[model samples]
Target: MNTINSILFIIFFLGIIGTIINRIHLLSLLLCLELLLVSLFINITIWSNSYDTLISLNYSIILLTFSACEASAGLTLLVSLSRTHKTDLLIKLNLLQT
Candidate 1:
């Protein structure tokens, strides 16, 4: 169980790093963000089970709600950006002027 938790932590950490370093596309960034949320949910579940408590479970539920909101917002932004720019590539966005 501990090993599994450790692996999840490493995976989550790597996912965050990958999201930061890889600017391939907006879709990939969203996917990575979802991956991070999933890893967090799993980690929270593992800890909650180990501790035999409901508090962590409640927290996990809240996390899931936030993740859903985050995913929706990201997709909305992606749609708007793609419609305006005709591309999902991060390099094409003009952040300074926008």
Candidate 2:
């Protein structure tokens, strides 16, 4: 069981890395955030199941809620940028003149 759990952890960690390294698309960034959130949910669920406790479940719920809030805010900002610039590409957002 330990080996199986370790394998899952490694796969999810790889997803986290992929998300971090992928900056070509704004949508990919959102996807990567979701992937990381899924990893957090999976880790907490597995730990809670192994220990036969409810704390991990509660924590996962809270974390998911926070993730939702973050995604909403990020999407709103992205939409605003798209409206002003007419593109979602990160490289094209430089119209802000920063």
Model 1's TM-score against the true structure: 0.90
Candidate 2's TM-score reads 0.81
Instruction: Write one digit per residue (lDDT tens) for candidate 2, span 35-92.
Output: 7787787788888998999988999899889889888988997899788878888876
lDDT of 1 by residue, 1-98 (tens): 56898899899998899899878799899989998999999899988998899999999999999999999999999999999999999998997895
lDDT of each: 0.92, 0.82
Model 2 per-residue lDDT at 31: 77
The TM-scores of all predictions, comma-separated, are 0.90, 0.81
Candidate with top lDDT is 1
Error of 1 at 87 (Å): 0.6
Residue 98 in model 1: shift from native, Å?
5.6
Total backbone collisions, model 2: 0
